[model samples]
Target chain A: MDFDIKRLGFTLLGLLIVLNWGLLMSSIMRKLGARVAKRYGIRWFQPWLDLVKNYALRSQISHGIMFYLGPVFRIGGGVGLFLFMPMIIGSELWLNYSFHGDLVLLMYFQFFGMLGMALGSGEGGHPYSAIGISRGLSQFTTIEVPMTLAIISLAIQYDTLSLIDIVKAQQGGFQNWTMWTNPVATIAGMFSLLGALSHSPFNLVKAPNEIPIGPPTEYHSTFLGVLQTNAAILHVVEAALFMNLFFGGATNWFEFILKTFFIYFWSVFVGVVFPRFRIEQSVAWFLKIPLVFGVLAIILYM
Target chain B: MSETKNNNKFENPHYAKREVTGPDGKQFIVDPIKDYFSDERPKVYEPNSIPVVEKFLNWARAESLWVLGFGTGCGSIEIPPLMTPRFDAFRFGIQSRPTPRQSNVFIISGYLAVKTLKRVIRSYEQMPSPKYVLALGSCTINGGMYFDSYNTINRLDHYIPVDVYVAGCMPRPEALLAAFNRLKELIKEGKGEKANEYAANFDWYKENQKKIIKDWNMPDYNW
Candidate 1:
């Protein structure tokens, strides 16, 4: 089979757009949080400035080679998810590299960054990094249970494992979307999305200003910049994936932006409203309500 | 100096050298300070050769000042308000980072006890180059009310090169914001080389620091 260079170029361009949109979305969400607290918040361009400053820092130190490869692997996971995901459904240029079994690959890509971070932060040797990694991995494991269940539900409903085909099935109108027809699975998926997003309630992984930050405690300069870059991409790509799954997939950039924003905002909204949960509390929480919803989703599909 | 009490009388067991069995049962000496820590001396990092690029970078650095969240003294009370609705320091691109490795601005808030000063020096050294120190409160200046107190040091600059001094018994958050602005101006004008200054005067700073921190068990540089 011949590789298509043109498709690769389009995907690269899509990645750039997704990255910028993710950064802007995060800034806007921060601004919203600030407004809620009756503060002016950070400037809209602050993230861009921070990225530049982090990259421009003069000195960089590493714990080991694994520490160096940590951020690389994380960005790899983010880019991999984007590569395999279909961004704008029904659009040839925005289809990315989505194929018959891309959903399974996307699920693997979702967890790839966390495992990479675990190795990297473990090498960092900061006690907090270890604590954070264990908390993150444990919470992530529970999160995956409900998320995987939801995906399995979708797979059974559609009778296909391909993300492109799933999106194709959901096309036509909003009523036809899985969110309406398969609300149970959508609910389970959205609940897990909160954990996936790692917002306020489930944000014990980083626990900034509490545990001296999490996995990236020892990361700085360019290494941190790479993590931030991946964060931006991962947020957008994950939102896009959800958009293609539950919400009707976007046919154009306008719908894509709107749907992705709302999907991303769902977590932010939940985050702003609730206080945080401790590691064990969050692990138990995922296993309880969301897990029940996940089981219910699968049973309904069956 | 009448016989100063030796704070180093007992070694910190954490930093003490000890033998440890590996996963495979082979024994090896584990000296925490020597084995775990980076012994590399701090080096002076110069700005970019191209004036334009350096100026641009300086602007970016100055615009996004990540202050270490470590609060040393009574003046720490003022820092919390900066994030409040009243001051809202985030609007100006000034934010607090939890770790030393990630932060460039270190606020020597109020008086520094000899015990705290040791940790301060460790944290200040751990921060990457192009860092700045904003000496807060009169306590950090001439020790303020703590001048006669044996516990706290009077002058902060002797241990760490300070860039901006925010004066007051306990400088209000407004004063801290003003200090931040002044720091930003200094950074943009290419005057924020305090990290390099510390490196150039590393021996002097370490000597001053060791004089106060009697139990100097950690490495010279925390990096």
Candidate 2:
């Protein structure tokens, strides 16, 4: 009902923890992947990661600066998203707020963090970094429409632009969660998340086998450490946000974390198993599915 | 943390020793560990009464020029096998990096066409100090093929001073090795500064690089 600065600060701190958690998870995932590669004698994977790390993080000062800046901008965008969208912290009386400005705001705001990273990488003056940024921006064009459709679906379901109101309306748990109620929309969201995370099958941005970890290739030192940390943290944030939107928040903190982790694990598992999609295929795939879902969500809501 | 952990677990198997057919074609055990431990840890060069052999070794180590993967010409293709197991340039402490930031050597492999020449200059400028350049072929030394094309610069050394010029349309890999040895010799004789002085004409190099890119209306790789 009321915005408290202290409460908001606490929430921001929790957000920081979530970001750090994402950074750690990404590192763990890479390490785990490398270890598996080593066991299988797939020698290239570990060395590949090491080379990228050295090129991007261990090389010099300029790269170091860009690497650290990546996460800060990412967190900034996350903060902005959390501020605008619906979030329900189930502490009985802790807080609940939702406001919808416009679909444009939510959609374009996502680009800020990504764009900042691209710019930072470009300034490092590495060809690979430039190549990566170009690929990343191009991928955006493909996923944006489908994701927008999903957003529109939610917008229609509540007949209001505010995300908080949507969550409040969908409070009846599993049956009320958008995915269960509207499977098409839920599936569309999953596909979009796949694109957003740059996960396997859609992982064009950091495709090691191709672009040599792209923009981060020139980053080094404390800067790269920060970027890597932020990457994992952003993953956690994205996963949590997805869970909050589509799956009911747990009645307790334990349940909440467990449910979120459950989703996170599934996402990671699916992500690791799938091979990366070519840029064109990813674009075409997202364009069709989410657009259809968007039309369906609109019709169903109407 | 993960890098260190993995680095510790993995012993750079690429650098490990195994049985290899010697020049006599007889199988001989080559133990890198034995070779590593057999010698006293090689120290950095000190301008003192170090033994001649030790001095030579240090000079070799210092000029063990690791190249960056900023390929600018047809000559760039030669780099792959040079670093592969057969050639194993790493024996000289020279490794190929994918980024220019970390490399101490810019092997301007061959002719710098107006198109790729801009990138070559940018890469050259990005490399840290105490760097050396090896003009790999006649094209890199004096634009052998495209000498009158106006698209290729006739003398790269006029732009970025070369320490050793390996002559050939495309110099054989052996020539590259020879050029490297020559660079080591020059370094031993305190001629490393000569390369740096030539490279230090930042203004002239920038102008020449700009003319190459602009006169030919060449597009950057991504652009």
Candidate 3:
């Protein structure tokens, strides 16, 4: 396997852009929530300040090797997932490393960071960390059912696992997008996306008193800063993944930003008005209507 | 032992001293005094090499002071109003964070009993670097009415470095906000970098801490 230095450089550039803009996106979402409560929220650069302070901390503690590597795994997963996909089409430079694999590989890499985090947090020796991961992974499996079914439906309908080909198929018109043609799959995918994003009603991983900020409880200083950056990028990348798969892939940066924000807000809107549910409730809720929608989506594709 | 007996340095015979086997197989007793007083010390603080970057960091750190949300004492009651529309603490980038790992400020809201002090020390130590401790009531400064009480510690600084002390039985929300303003000033000037001071004076602080905390079942450091 030959390596292209230019492609690698562009990949890094793309990751940096995503991570930087990702913080701004999150702060905007936070401001939106604060406005709903009639309060002036933090400035857009506030998250950046927090990140700097965390990194500039005078001291830090480590539980062990695995505990140290948890955030490393998390950031790795975020960057890896983005690099595997085609960011822009119709040009070789924009293809990323898509020639190396297909959506099947991208699908598998989705679990890479999460599984690493689970293993790393388990090593941190905090009961809350363990409990959080246990709840998170359990809730994680239920949501995967609908999302997986939706993806399978898309791949089957398009007759390809290559994301470039999939994106190309939807070009030339708005109505050709999977979101319009396969509304059932889009609903199922977005509903499952809510759980994937860990918004309210499915945020049992961050239960009020049960877990002290969940899996990241033991992480501090630069370790946490790394995780925060990764989280920001990962959220945007996850939203972008849906945009490409459902809405038509962006022809330019403006379209990319608009679609990703719209997809992200769909989950945020659901989170705002709903009260939280128990882990069991979230799992059962997914298994019911969302899972039915998933099966229906597959049947519709057939 | 005789010379320091009046200074209250008598070792309690009831508690067995902990012994550890070093990595090279040398067995040694764990003595806080001996470990603390030894001439040599382990280096911990990184050199503040870049003045421009350091200045910027201090300002940023000052700006985003995420107070640990848990109230350690009665002063905790004043915290809610600070968040309400009337006070709005978030406007200054000062908000309550749920976890100790993420928080930069720990507001010891009121008096600290011997029992609670142990937990406070543990929580305070668990907080990441550049952490600030603000004692909210007179009780934390000198135990106030609990000054003569057997269960409370009079001077909070004896156990950990305190950055600010807001005087009141239970200060009002406005007082708390004023204290935050003072804290922000200290942080802005880069004068309140006491986390490293606490680490540098670890033995002295632990000696003072163990003086009152009789049942010290926890490890040497909370981490």
Candidate 4:
């Protein structure tokens, strides 16, 4: 357990690169969506401007200390995921602090932000925050069932719990990737990714029209800017996790960007094609189709 | 002015004072107006002393005007078209936000009835400082056809500070876009300090609001 300052610096640098990439990818996706609807999209630099504007807001009101810590915990979760996730498979510098059993830790980090948001938004005392937390937690719980089942299938297939090892196992060729060798588990994992990403069809938690932007309804100013920052980092990190587990991790920055973009796009592609589901319908939908694939994945491994 | 009537019929019970038992079995008086809401007065935040920093922030603010999507009147129909392909206000960084806390621009579209004015005032106060109001339509200017009506207010600026006005019976989406551009120009010029103006004239604005609102169940300042 030797701690090195250089390693820490590289990890922080890696996080920065991922954050910028995430912002660019989001704006690009938004532009694509706008084009689809026959409308001009926001400028590519819009997200950066919004981030600045939110932080530049002169006034801020707080409900409690937890309200302040909410965004802190959320960004902590995003950073925690990055800390243990190996970005480029064969690169020693970008491997971060990933160790044996990091896969399990990554799973826990995925849900960490939501729980923190629940506590923070609950303290805000906005009724919509409560409704959103309930829906988000329930939907996220169901999403985890399929995702965890797929991971279990992968663990059984590779006989390891480390993401680095999992990525290593898939290296050499595309045929060796879990998407080919363990298609059932990949399907289950990919299906849950749509929910995990919280895009249109599964976006009831923050149903802007219905719930008035949900959990962060009361979050404003620098608080909201932090959430937006975490959102950018989290999206890319989540895609990176999937990239490592299923797509045979990247050996370089270019490969990393290309793979993560397509992985993130999978959910966005599904989102635009489908209409939203109610909380009940979404929870039930995840339990049915993705759950079945998850079970089938596990059974295949057994 | 006539004696202000206590409009008990319109008073919301949830906002009324009552006793509540906490989870620990402790009883406490709960006055929603005083206990649930922040009573702090809005303060005027002076611009940054450094010219470069202030100018940069103003530029960012101008480029990203998150409009509160609460349409007050008939001019609301004009807003939806701004999001459509024909207008597409997104390209100009004029996006709609669902909540007041996140938005800096409040569009007082069309005429403001006394009833909707209360909600508008609350939403306006809740917005963070350096906020701007884009009063749309002749309804907001002089009540348009509603000038003789018993309920609608003739001038919106009497109740809330308005930064830009788009004059029309109901301004078309193109006109609204022009108003947004004007608002952005004002913001970039560091002239969008109407939120501070409302704070400076707090008593006068509150008196004007209370004169028409009647019930006045909520606090003077919504924060």
Kept native contacts, fraction for each prediction? 0.83, 0.05, 0.70, 0.89
Candidate 1 Cα lDDT to native = 0.91
Error of 3 at B148 (Å): 3.0
Clashes of 2: 13
Better of 3 and 4 by DockQ: 4
Model 4 chain B: ten consecutive residues of lowest lDDT: B1-10
Candidate 3 chain A weakest lDDT stretch, 10 residues: A204-213
Cα RMSD for predicted model 1: 3.2
Interface Cα RMSD of candidate 3? 1.8
Report the CA-based lDDT of candidate 4 relative to the real structure: 0.91
TM-score of each: 0.97, 0.53, 0.90, 0.97
TM-score of 2: 0.53
The pairs that clash in candidate 4 are none
Every model's DockQ, to 2 decimals?
0.80, 0.05, 0.52, 0.84
Residue range A13-57, candidate 1, lDDT tens digits: 999999999999999999999998999999999999999999999
The regions of model 1 sitting more than 4 angstroms off are B1-8
Put down candidate 4 lDDT per residue, A1-302, tens digits, no spaces.
78888988999899889989989999999888888889999999999999999999999999999999999999999999989999887778799989734688999999999999999999999999899899899999999999999999999999989889899999998999999999999999999999998998999888678789999999999999999999999999999999998999999999999999999998888888899999999999999999999999999999
Error of 2 at A118 (Å): 3.0
lDDT string, candidate 2, B106-176, tens digits? 88877787667666755665554446788878887667878888678888876676778888988777777
- lDDT by residue (tens digit), candidate 3, A238-273: 888888899888887777788878888877788887
Name the lDDT value of residue B115 in candidate 3: 88
